[model samples]
Target: MGMGGMRRQGSDFEPEFFRIFRSIEDQQKRSAWLQAEGMLAAAPMLRARGLPLAADDPGEVSLEAERAAAEQQMLEALVRSGVPFLLAGPSLAAWTLYPEPGRRPRESMDLMIHARAVNDARAILRDEDFVPDPRGATRTESAQAWRRSKASVQLSIRLRWDFCDHPILNRRFSIAGLQAKSVVIEKPVAGLRALGVEHATLYSALRWVDAVHERFRLVDLFDQDLRWRMLGKEKLAELALLARQRGVAGILAEHLGMARRVFGTPVSTELLHSLKQSGNHERSGSLLGAGRGRMRYHLLGALYGRGLRVRGRHLFSLISPG
Candidate 1:
């Protein structure tokens, strides 16, 4: 359902705020402030109304446990090697939503590391024959090749190939002021494992760009929040503002929306307000009008246009005075 249909009653932030945030003009600054206000405002109102927010619930907690289990092993391995890495994309999301792996994974553990580290990771996995694709061609070509090979390998296990050598991969991995810190993931049978945070956050956001067709997963956002929390809300607010200035508010918003939809929680209002202020509403909307495949593409484009800006900001940050 659209944002309007998704609103649960008693939410202090009006659903309209989201709709407007999706389609506003020149109020990137204003929307962001309002978003923060709404979030701060929501807490008391929600408390007064006795409404429950989904930050930590049983199902979510269970899922996090499963994700944690799956992640710790991989992380501990990376840490042992002294790899300069960070958790990015689905893995972080899964970790946030469910800190341990379950009987099954909602999504594979995706990690983002400096470009220099890809070969290192590939080397580690190579003993198991998990080598990186050497097509040296565009991702589209690789995806096609993978599809052709799908008959031989389990499609899901092989899906990781499509993710290799992605253009966005570079941006997320080589972000300015990039840093790493360890997070613990639990393995029911194996004790604890360690993973990097910075890389994981970038990867998770980048994953949203490609996983356009997959079912929206809320756990990712929960992870984003957790990653953001680890990174510090101050940085999130700074990035949110920077993302807007770069014209990526729409992209960030869409991803934030996906997080809300999947996880049943809103992204930080402060971050939202910052993005809204950055996004010029006059230019936002369903650019493709209406069509079958077009809806996703249109929405994706609106978001990407904004994302390019955010990415651009990161690019600039990488070089700017610290």
Candidate 2:
């Protein structure tokens, strides 16, 4: 079919799709979703839980400076500890794909370390004065907090370090597999590092599916938008194939469909149609319901439970306030 005809056929639910897309794009809706998920506060919110910010100087400039210092210290500590690791999450996103100044600055840095080196890395973090936040962390134990010093910003900055070999959506993704497929590149500020754009993109898509299935969050949708913009037709084709191989074709197709309809994200019409044909019809219906509200999406998740395999514990971690 021609591209125009294909777009029409592919977007049969455009009205409902865009409605949901715009809702997620709305800042108020996004904030409400983050607040509901308990991720809205990075460090300042943790003050009540004993990890106080620089109470005397809580200005944005101070906070930004502290965060920058903390990130540099954390990276230095990781290197000093001799632990093999790769940067992921928003920091990496900023480094590689989305360089928009208006994009929200990440609250923490996410690092994936070799499984065997996790203990050593943890020890290094502890020596650096970093401690576990234990707020929203569940299956994968992510470390947070450094020290409570006025000079160091009082442990306000947080870092999440996870073992490279871990389960995402209940599926195992090994570090070796990641390293083999990841694109190695040099960062202007951070030097040479592995940029797992493909893996990160796929992971973001899966996270978005989980958000729809559990609680609707704007950050997840925003992440999808960022990663989607970073990828091209070749990369997306590879990602689609990876999702199929990883048993997440339905989930990928559903979110890609939503992104295409809402953000006008670039996705091949042919690719979308093929994925939809191979994916679950139930999920397609759920995606349509998701644009309406949380209740509809939850009902669909309860009814279908197909497409992606999100562990019960993982689902709890996504929704639970940490």
Candidate 3:
């Protein structure tokens, strides 16, 4: 989560620069101002609920600055921690395109943990005062939590099944493999950070890039593209080899296609055919409906051909074109 090349420079100071910056183009500055106003507007609500806004809260002007700094510190801390994590959502965006602090980050700090270690991670978080979400009826389900501090810093935790860590894929990874790819950062929050390329590549292939999923997130594709572009061919090959060894050849193949489509780098045909012949097909389409199931063949074929880009606003726009 250290600063990526996308951080905004002094030239982005103009309000108009934010307007065309994609996420903030339309109502970016307005949204930031709204958040400032909302904080101020909530005073009545807080008072009605016996939680009056502090008179010495430094008013809206200072409050925004304070909130931004607090969030930045938390991000720094996350980067410093040695825990395996990746910047997802708006955090990644902010890191990539250096946005103004007043522009609220849209995504939270999302970290991936092996499903098997979820219990252990939850235990660690609980000790830090993160209680499990009680919204669901079942108590013994997958773990999740959200916590906030008096300073207005927010934290969220979710335990999910990592598509790359599947038994099939794990078998081929080297001793250090994904574990060796982590880096330690010292900002926003300190923690272990994984290679953004690997994280984004795996994420797009497993979930976002596939035609089977309906969720269209151009940001995810763009993030993967950015990371992949930053990662030269050698690193991409190493990742491909790692995936192939893990028996997730198919996923990696698809990932390469996604990289080519979104980032404009074509993956080899040999790699594509190889993965299709290696991975388990049953687990691939379990979540997709029939239409999506049909879409895969076409997408796969197209991947073998020209490949697609992350741009455009079609159904495939939400997903990686390959």
Candidate 4:
């Protein structure tokens, strides 16, 4: 779902405020503010509304347990329905890449499925009482999401499930490719599948680029930085090769460069040089380059790329209180 459509009913800040915050040039200040807001403000606000703040927060322990149970239940349901899926995004990151506990409390769980199975997946979710989130939905895309909730501590806590038929980064990498490249995680949640660290790294980088055009979230940068730190140099070389094979080498390089600039991510110089030498970095480099290079042009282009209907919907949502 676009950030434009992701308003919480009781949020103190408008969704547009988040979009503006992302455009702030000061990375350190933005990260610090985000950390403070997440801990002192967003967590309490969400917890008061019966949302899970973090897996390790004492006040929200019950909510965390319920979320875990709900995730397992949903996974078991999908397994019974015979739908093939791999959990993606922050949920996977929390389990594998992220180092600290409760560091990233995801608001939703992202699932990737083959395009042909989307209807089946939707049916399964509906069977479990998940309803479509119209505010965050579009009719044409191969992506759809639903939300399910149960009463908790006088209010209700919600779990969101996002189903995507295409790779989260570039649509060119097919679901079959993702499935073939996925790795299995057996503990904490058995039979769980996730993208390999190399592929996941590339996805994280592309996701950062997406944030550059849409809404910037510090968590996105942190995910890349932490994952890069964990994956180290050899894995990055593998990621570079995978990006080349997937035809997203330039895009990968461009975002990696951005991560270095914005968060001081430690991408190896050799990998950067290798990617640039491949001659595929020009398109994304021109569009999402660091500092003052063509970012405004690209942002405008991205706004236009969302099309009139989506843009109008966002504007309308921004202005309407409901």
Best by lDDT: 4
Ranking by TM-score: 4, 2, 1, 3
lDDT string, candidate 1, 210-290, tens digits: 443455433344456545545666656565654554344654655565555433444665555556555545133222113
Candidate 3 stretches greater than 4 Å from native: 1-72, 75-105, 113-155, 159-177, 186-192, 209-214, 255-322
How far in Å is the alpha carbon of 173 misplaced in model 1?
Answer: 6.7
Candidate 4 lDDT, 131-222, residue by residue in tens: 77654453224456577734341211122122221122335466777789899876346677777788677766655554332345656655
- TM-score for all predictions? 0.49, 0.61, 0.48, 0.65
Candidate 3 residue-wise lDDT, 1-322, digit = tens: 1111212224322222122223444444633433432323223322443432344233543544455565565545444443344444434433442323333233234445556556655555555556654431111122243444232544444443343222222223332344466544443444535435554466556544233323344344444544555667787777676655544556555555544443344455566666666655534433233344535433433333221321112224236442
lDDT of 4: 0.55
Q: Using alpha carbons, what is the TM-score of model 1?
A: 0.49
lDDT of 2 by residue, 220-279 (tens): 455666588777778877887777776567667767766665445666677877876666
C-alpha RMSD for every candidate: 12.9, 10.2, 13.7, 10.6
C-alpha local distance difference test of each model? 0.42, 0.51, 0.42, 0.55
